[model samples]
Target: MTQKRISKELQECLTTPPAGIKVNLVDEGNIHNWNIVMDGPADSPYVGGKFQLLLVLPTEYPFKPPKINFKTRIYHPNVTFDEHGSMCIGILKSDSWKPSSRIPNVLTAIQQLLLEPVPDDAVEQGAAQKFKEDRKAFDKEARDMTKKYAK
Candidate 1:
């Protein structure tokens, strides 16, 4: 039942994706896992980059939030450093996630996160510091990393 709901949502997202983002199942048989690629929003530091994330649904999904982790290494304050690429978004976390939220909402939130990072709660301290102290350098590093990974 959970898988069916997720599959239906995936189909809806694929057919009518939010602006500059795409979502699909990681494998045909795995409705519990999804692969998402987001195009950076215009005028943001992440512009021109394609970011990837893995979304894993728990057995009791919708009631429980899905797990989201970045598959592409990015130079972002919200993404973790250890190459694990974990995101520091509120909605993805258990505390803030809502059962009513859909896949499109999650992907949109991620894209918005790229455009405007939540520096107060940062996963990558260095990147967060850079973002706050040196805007140009931060942008450069983010752009460079995007070029390398977001293919």
Candidate 2:
């Protein structure tokens, strides 16, 4: 049941991806793991960067929200600056997630996050502080990191 649903969603995503986003399976035989290439939003500091992300759907997908992690590092208040590259987003939260939510919506939300980060609800305190205290520095650092790691 889960595989069928995932395959359907995957096909839809591949055929019609969200703006600045491309999707593919991590492996041909596996339908649960996905590889995503998201183009940085033009208005944001991350522009010109190609970010890679991993999205994993559980066996109980739809009932459970999919998990996404940045394979390419990003400097953002909502994303941890570590090897894990975990992100903090409202839609992906289990309590907020609904089975009716689609993958395209999730990908769009991620793009929105890059365009406008929620510093108050940040996971990375340092980035949040810089974002809140010094906007210029934050943008510069984010752009620098985007060049260094998001290339």
Candidate 3:
């Protein structure tokens, strides 16, 4: 059941991909993991950067939300700056996630997060505080990080 659903979702994502986002299977035999490449939004600090990400669907997917981590570093309040690059997005939250949610929706939400970081629900508290208190510095740091890490 999990494989069938993953295959179906994978096909749909490949056929009708979201803007600035590209997704591919990590391994031909593994439908559970995906490699994603996303172009940063023009209006954000991450503009002109290409970010890589990993999305992993659990064996009990549809019952549990998929996990996404940035393979590239980003200096946003919602995304961690270290190796983990963990992100905080509303839809991916266990309580907020729904079985109907798709990969495209998740990618789109990520793009929106880059455009406007949700400081209140941030994963990196210092980055969030900087974002709220000093918008310019936050943008500069984010852009610098995007240039350094995000190719």
Candidate 4:
């Protein structure tokens, strides 16, 4: 059931992706794991940067939310270091996730997060502090890191 839904979603995303985003399966056999490439929103601080994300679906999806993490290193308040890449988005959490939410929505939310970070609930403490204190420096570092890894 989970596989079927994921397969359909994957097909749809591949056929018609939203602007500035692309999705592909990480492995041929694993429909549960996906590789996402998102272009930074236009005119934003992150503009012209490409970002990579990993999406892993649970065995019981819909009923359970998929896990999303950054595969490309990004300096962001909501993403942690150590390459663990845990995201700090409300929709990814159990408390906020809804059964009706789909992969497209998740991807959209992640892109939105890049444009507007939620510093109060941070997974990367240093990035969050920098973002709060020095917006310009944070933007520069984020843009540099995005160019380095997302290219």
Candidate 5:
């Protein structure tokens, strides 16, 4: 059941992906893992950067939300500043996630996060502090990191 649903969602994403997002299977033989390439929004500090992400679906998927992690490091309040680049986003949270939610919607939400980060719910405290205290500095640091890591 999970496989069938994932295949349907994958096909839909491939056929009409959200703007600035591209999706592909991580391994041709495995449908459970996906590789995502997301272009940073033009209006954000991450503009001109290309971010890579990994999305893994559990066998019990649809009953559970997919796990998404940034393979490309990003300097954002909601994303940890480490090799792991674990992100904190509401839609991916188990409580907020719904089986009805689709991949495109998830990708769109991520894009929106880039455009407008929620500093109060941040995973990276330093980044959050900078974001809240010094907007210009935050944008500069984010752009610098994007150039360094997301290029």
Candidate 6:
């Protein structure tokens, strides 16, 4: 049941992909893992950067939320600035996730996170504090990180 649902969502995302985002299964026979590439949105520090991500669906997907992690480094309040780049997206949380949610919506929510980081619910406390207290410095650091890692 999980495989069938994942396949359906994968096909839907492929057929009607979100702008600046592309995704593909890691293996043709396996529907549990996906590779994603996202272009950073403009008017933000990450503009001009292309970020890679991994989306792993558990065997009980639809019943459990998918795990998304940045394969590439990024500097944002909601995304940890490290190799793991674990993100803090509200929609992906077990508390907020719904079985009705689809891959496209998840990707869209990620994009929105890039455009607007939620400092109040940050994964990286320092980054969140900087983002909330010093917008200019935060943008500069994020842009620098983008150039170093995402470019």
lDDT of 1 at 87: 85
Off by over 4 Å in 3: none
lDDT of 2: 0.95
Residue-pair clashes per candidate, as listed? 0, 0, 0, 0, 0, 0
lDDT accuracy of residue 70 in candidate 1: 87
TM-score of candidate 3 against the unseen true structure:
0.96
Residue 59 lDDT in candidate 3: 93
**Model 4: colliding residue pairs:** none
Candidate RMSDs in order: 1.3, 0.6, 1.0, 1.3, 0.6, 1.0
Candidates 3 and 4, the one with greater lDDT:
3
- In model 3, pairs of residues that clash are none
Model 1 weakest 10-residue run by lDDT: 81-90
* lDDT of each residue in 46-65, candidate 5, tens digit only: 99999999999989899899
lDDT of 6: 0.92
Local error of candidate 1 at 129, Å?
A: 0.7
Top candidate when judged by lDDT against the true structure: 2
lDDT of each: 0.85, 0.95, 0.92, 0.86, 0.94, 0.92
Tens digits of per-residue lDDT, candidate 1, 1-151, equal 7877877788898899899988888898878888888888898877888888888999899889999888888888988855678987878778888888998888888888888988889989999999999999999998888888876
Q: List the candidate numbers ranked by lDDT, top first.
A: 2, 5, 6, 3, 4, 1
Q: Model 6 Cα RMSD, Å?
A: 1.0
Tens digits of per-residue lDDT for model 4, 1-151: 8778888888989999878899988998989999999898875567888878889999999789999988777788988865778888889889889988998998889889988999999989999999999999998898887777767
